[model samples]
Target: MSFWDDRYSRDEYVFGEAPNAFLAAQSHLLPKSGKALAIADGEGRNGVWLAEQGLDVLSLDASPVGLEKAKKLAAKRRVKLSTKLLDISDYDWPAERFDVVAGIFFQFAGPDLRDTIFAGMIETLKPGGLLILQGYGPRQLEYKTGGPGILENLYTEALLAEKFSALEIFHLGDRDGEVAEGSAHVGKSHLVDLVGRKAG
Candidate 1:
């Protein structure tokens, strides 16, 4: 078992069962009902919530244990969830395949890997598709509340702009505040929120 598998093997959900506040707040921006993709969706909190909102959701995670827990959560919610085990590094994200793609607190890569993943996400989205993402900002290292704890694995509005330049950015901001999502993400932290649509 890998590190993430071990982390999720506990009976408790490492990141809590509630959806990320940022993702929940931005839910209104999504299409009322459409095909949605939740990348790196650990334990399926956001995916299940999306399903509750009437979206056809497919959750892709690298951790089988985590995805199993996600499955259980989906069952508890009485919602249908499609899960795929994949590593983003080799994920075959076809072009214009989804109406929405969400990556909440999901980015954890160095610059090179991030560029590839970001590009793949942008490519996989349908024209005018929404991309909702939230992640730790470079300043997160100072707070050390959550995240990969390296600048290379962090984000900034400038980086998002550069990375998803093909998309029309609707919202992008950085803030430091309390984001107690669960035991893993507790206390104050630096975060970046992004909402953008692929150019039609």
Candidate 2:
């Protein structure tokens, strides 16, 4: 089993069954009905939430175990969720295919890999589509609430601005706050959030 597979084998959702607070807060920005992509969506929390919001959601993760749990969660929630097993390193991100792309707490990638994934997130967006992302900021190393321990795996305002520069960034900021997602992320954390839109 892969790292994520092992991590998700637990009886409980490590990150909890609720959507990320930041993503939930951005609900108003989502289209009433459209395609959405949830990256690294473990146990389908965010993807399921997106489906509940009337969007055709595709949840992508590298762990089969996690994907299975995601499907089960979707059924329990009575919402449709499509899941795919994909490694972001080699993913062929479809161009202009989704109305929204969300990457919440996906800070496991290092600099090089993150660059590829970030670019793909931008590429997959439909014109005027929204790109939402929230991740641990550099200071997260101090909080150690959740996310990778490596500093390079954490996000910074400048890094995000440069990475998703193709889009018209409307909201971008970093701050310390309490994050209660699940057992994994429950405490004060340094976080950065970005919301941008592709040119129509």
Candidate 3:
């Protein structure tokens, strides 16, 4: 078992069963119904919430243990969630395949893979599709509440602006606040949230 598998083998959902705060706050902006992709979604929180809102959602993560728990969470919520086990580095990202793509606190190891992942995310969306993402900010290292220990994986407004320049940015900013996401992420943290639409 891997590190995440070991962590998820325990009885609790590390990030709670509710959707991410940023995603929840921006839910009104999502289409009423469409195909949605949740990247690195563990325990089905965000993906399942999208399903509940009537979107056909796919929850992709690298951890089988976590995905299995996600299945149970979907069942408990009486929603259908499609799941796929994938590592973004090798994921065969298809072109223009989705109406919405969400990546909440999905950390990347470095710039190389991060670039590919960012490119893939843009490629995966149809023109005018929505993209919502959130991640730890550079200052997160000072807090250590949750997120990558490496500064390279952290985010900044400039990074998002540059990376997703092809998209029409709707919201891109950083904030410091308390994140009460179960036992794993509970404390004040700094994070960046990004929202945009692919230009037609």
Candidate 4:
């Protein structure tokens, strides 16, 4: 079994069944109704929440075990969530198809793969589409709450600005905060958030 598959084989959702706080706070920016892409959606917390908000959501992840759980969560929430098994590194991203793309706490990729995924996220957005992203900052290593141990996998304001330069970034910053997502992500944390819009 894959690493993530093993991680998710347990009965409980590793990251809980609630949407990421950062993503949930962007409700005002969400489109009334359109397609949304939830990257590395794990157990469908964020994706199912998006579906609850009346959007067509596609939850993509590298773990079938996680995707299966996501499907179950959608069923429980009475929302429609489509899931796809994707490795992210080699997936063919669609062009200008989604109204919103959320990548909350998806910090598994190193710089090279990150660049590819970030670019594809931009490419997949329709004009004026919203891009919501959140990740652990360098300080996360110190916090030891959650996220990759690799410093290179963490995000900085400058890195996000440079990678998503094509988008019209309105909010980008990092700060120390309490992250109580689930058993997997809980306690003091360093978080980075970015909200950008693709040009119309």
Off by over 4 Å in 2: none
Question: Against the unseen true structure, what C-alpha lDDT does each candidate score?
Answer: 0.89, 0.93, 0.89, 0.94
What tens digits encode model 1's per-residue C-alpha lDDT throughout 15-70?
A: 99999998898877888988999999989999999888889999999999999999
Model 3's alpha-carbon lDDT is: 0.89
Residue 86 miss distance in model 3 (angstroms): 1.6
Q: Candidate 3, residues 1-200: lDDT per residue as tens digits?
A: 88888989989898999999889888788889889999889788999998988899999999999999999999999999999998868787789888899988878558788888889899999888999999999889999999978999889999999999999998998899899998878898998889999987
Which ten-residue region of model 3 has the weakest summed lDDT? 105-114
For model 4, residues 55-114, the per-residue Cα lDDT tens digits are 999999999999999999999999999999989887788999999999988888999899
Model 2 residue 79 lDDT score: 98
What are the C-alpha RMSDs, in order, of all predicted structures? 0.9, 0.7, 0.9, 0.7
TM-score of each prediction? 0.97, 0.98, 0.97, 0.99
Q: Candidate 3 — which residues are off by over 4 angstroms?
A: none
* Candidate 1 displacement at residue 176 in angstroms: 0.8
